[model samples]
Target: MTATGDADLSVVAAALGDRGRARMVLAVTDGRALPASTLAGEAGVSAATASAHLRRLVDAGVLRAEQHGRFRYFRLAGPEVADLVEALGRVSPPQPVRSLKEGTRAHALRLARACYDHVAGRLGVALTDALLDAGHLVGGDGADSGRRDGDRLPGLDVVDYSLSADGRTVLTGLDVAVPDAAPVRCCVDWTEQRHHVAGPLGRALLTTMTDRGWVRPARRSRALTVTDEGRTALVDALGLVWPPPHGPDRVPGERTALSRA
Candidate 1:
C-alpha cells in the first residue's frame, strides 16, 4: 500500500478551499455534467474566473471536463469524488440563509435527498427504519448488540446491518440483486445527525425505487419527490405513512419518518 504521508491530500484541500470553486463542485455533485456557464453562475463568478477555477479542478483530478463542440461540461471524476463532497457536508456547518426561500430549500434538502448513490436525510433514515420494522433487515442496538451469540445491548447508536432471510426474498422478488460485498453499512447523515443506511444494499434499494418510478428528481434540485405509487407501495411494504396535513405550505402525503434522534 502507498504511504499516507505521500498522498496528495493537500491538492484536493486546496481545490476545495475556494468558495467559488466549492460552489461549482457542489452544483455538479448530483452525478450530472453541467456547462461551464451554469457552474459559473452557481459560483457567482464571471465566465473567465469560473473557467480558471474549473481548469484547476480538472488538473487536480477532482472533476472531468468533456468537450462538446463549443461548450464544455464538467462532472465529478468518479463516485469517490461525490463521496468526498457528501462527507464534507457532514463536517461543515450549515449555510446561513437570509430569506424564507433559502430556508425552505434547506428544509427540502433535509427532507429527502441523495448522498451520492444512496438515499439520505430523514427519508433515508425512514427507509432504513422501515426495513428493520418489517424484519426485512435486522440490525442495530438490538438484543445481543447484534452479535451471533445473542448479547443484548440497549441504546447503542448502531452496531451493524444485515439482511434477514425475508429481506433476501423481498429484494430478489423485486428483481434487485443483493450486493456480494459490503452489503450493509451505515452513513452518518449530515442533516439529521444520525446514521442512515449505505453501501451495496442501499444502492440497490435506491436503484429499484428509481426503476419502479417511485421517486423522481425534483426540478433543478437534489430533492426527490415521492410519487403517488411510491407512497402506496411504501405504506404497503413497510407500514410507513407520510403527510400529517398541516394546511397551506403542506404537500399532502409528504411524510418523512423520524425515529429516536
Candidate 2:
C-alpha cells in the first residue's frame, strides 16, 4: 500500500493470490523471459491453464509478454514486481520439494542466486556481514537511516547500513562506479532470515563481479557460480578467511564459497 490508503494494492495482491501464478512469478524473478511452456512446467500447470494465468498476470501489470518468432515469452513487468516477489518469499513458508531435481535446484537457489538485479541467498547475506565486519558499511543495527522502518515484523530487529568512504575506495578499486547518492536499502532474505546488501552498493558489486568475470549467470536459472578468480578475489575483497579464528566451520576446499555466505 502507498502512504495513503488505496485500493490499487489490492490489484497486486489478488494477482499474487494464486499458487500457480506465484510459481510463475518466482520462475522469472531472475529477470529472464521464459516461453509459456517453460512457465507451465515451472508452475506444474497445463498449457491452457498457464495461458489463462499469464493473461491475468499481464493484465494486472505484474508481467509482460513478448512474441518472438513463433514463441511467446513472459517476464515480470518490472523490478518492482521482482521486489514484491522477494518480499513475499520473506513471509511465505518454503514450498515443498517433490523430487531430486527440484531439491537440487532449490538448494542451488538458496546458496547463491540473484535476487533481481542484486546478489542474494547465502552469498548475499555473508557479503553484507563481511562489509559490516570490515567497517566498509556504516550504521547497521537500525542506525543507518536514523528513522525506524514501519512495516517489518513486530519483534524482528531491523539493521540498516550505508556505504562508508573506505567502501567507495574499495568499489572504485574494483572498477565499479558507485552512484553519487546513497541508496541504502535492506532486503530480508527468505532462507537466511537475515539482511543482505540491496541498494546501490549491491547493484555495483554485482555488476563489477559480472564484468570482471568473477561470476557468471547459470544457464536457464538464477544461480550464479563464482569463477576460479572470484573465489580468491571475493575472499580478498571481503577479508574472509575460511574458518576464521572466531568464526564458523571452514568452507569446502571446492570453489563454491557460497557456504561461507
Candidate 3:
C-alpha cells in the first residue's frame, strides 16, 4: 500500500501552536457556533487578529465556518475536534479562580450545566448514575476501566457508554425517539474532575430534557437550572434525586469548568 501523504497532525499542531489561536479554538469548542467578534473577545485579541487566526484554522480543517447574512459563525470541525480539546484539557493545568464571579460561575458549571453539546456538573453526574443504576448503560467493567467497587454514586469515571437492549426498550416505552445511528463518546469535565456522556446519546438526552422543560439555561451563563418538572421527571423516569436546597459556592482552582467536553 502506498503511504498516504504526511499526516495532518503536523498541520493541526502548527495551527494550535499560537496561544491566541488555541484559546479561540477552546472558546468555540463548547459546541456553540460563535461569530468572529465573540471569538476575538474570548481570545483577548483584536478582531482582525482573530480573523486571521480563524482563517488559518479553517484552512487547516480544524474548524468550519458558516455564513448567515452578515455574520460568519465558526465551530470545531466535529466531535473529533471536541475529543482532542477534551484530551488536552485533561493534561493542561487548571486556571486560577480570579474573582468571586468567576468562582461562582465555575461552581455553577460544576453543579448543573452543558459543556458544549453535552451535560456536566452535578446534574450530569446524577444523570449518568441514574442511567447506570437503571441498566441503561453498560461496559465499564474491564480492569483498565475507570469504575471501581465501593465508589460513590454519580461517579464520572465511566470509560464508555452505550444504550443497553433494555435501554432501547425503556426509551421506546417513554416515547423518546432515538436516532438509528448515534455515537457514543466521553468528555472530561474540568470543574468536576470527572467525565460525562458526550456524543450522540449525550446530545439526545440534553435535547429531550430541554424540550420537556425539565431544565433551562441561566441567562448570560452556561449554568443550568433544574425546574420543578425536571426534578420530578428525573426521579420518576430515571430514579435520580437532586440535592436539596442547592446553592452556589466556590470550588478550588484545580477543579473548574470543562473547557471542551
Candidate 4:
C-alpha cells in the first residue's frame, strides 16, 4: 500500500481506537441514525465529550452526520464501515462481563443481533443453515463450486451464495419481497465464525421479519428478539429452530428436525 493509503487507514483506526468512540460506533452498527445525546449515554460519556468524539469520527470518514428536523444524527458511513466493525470484532478478544446487565447484553448480542442491515450472530447463522438445509439457498458452505454470473458482490469477496428457485418461492410465500435481481452474498459472522445471508436478499429477509412482528430490535442495542408469534411463524415457514442452537445453557448443534415443505 502507498504511504497515503497507510496514513488514511491509520486515521480511521485512531478514531475508533478510543473506548468511548468505539462504543458509539457499535451502538449504531445496526444502521440506526442516532443523535449526540443518545450516543453520549451509550458511550457513558458526557454530552460534550461525546460531541467531540462524534466530530472526530465524522472527520475521519468513519461516520456521517445528517440533519433531521432540529438535531443532527450520526450513522456509520455505509455498509463498508459495518464490515470493518465486524472484522475488528472477529479478531478482538471478548470483553469481560463486569455486571449482570453487561452479561445479559453480551449474551443477547451473541445470540441474535443485526450486523448492519442484515441478521447476524448465532441466530443469523442458524437461519442461514436452515435455508441451506431446506434447499432455499446454495453455496453457503464456503465452497465456490456453484459460482455463476452475478454471484459476487462488487468490492466484497462475499462467498458465491445464491438464492435457489425454490428459495424465491419460499420467500414470496413468507411475504418477503427481495429486490429484483438482487445478488445473494454471505457475511462472515464475527460471533459464530459462520456465514449468514447478506446483500440485498438478506436485507429483505430482516425487513420482512421486522415488518411482520417476527423480530424486534432492543432499545439502544442491535440485539433482536424473536416474538412468540415469530417463533411459530419462522418454524412453520423456514423450519428455523428457536432459542438458537447454541448459547448459554444450550448445546451446540442440538437441533430438531426441520419441517420442510
For each candidate in turn, the TM-score is 0.78, 0.81, 0.74, 0.87
In model 4, pairs of residues that clash are: none
Q: Write the per-residue lDDT of candidate 4 for residues 78-156, one digit (tens) a residue.
A: 9999999988987799988999999999999988898889998878877887788787888645322324547563223
Off by over 4 Å in 3: 1-8, 141-161, 180-195, 218-223, 244-261
lDDT of 2: 0.74
RMSD of 3: 7.4
- Runs with alpha carbons beyond 4 Å of true place in candidate 4: 1-7, 142-158, 247-261
Give stretches of model 1 more than 4 Å off: 1-5, 141-159, 241-261
The candidate that achieves the highest lDDT relative to the unseen native structure: 4
Which candidate order results from sorting by lDDT in descending order? 4, 2, 1, 3
- Residue pairs clashing in model 3 are 30-116, 191-256
Error of 2 at 211 (Å): 2.1
Best by TM-score: 4
Model 1 TM-score, 2 decimals = 0.78
lDDT, residue 190, model 1: 63
| TM-score computed on alpha carbons, candidate 2 | 0.81
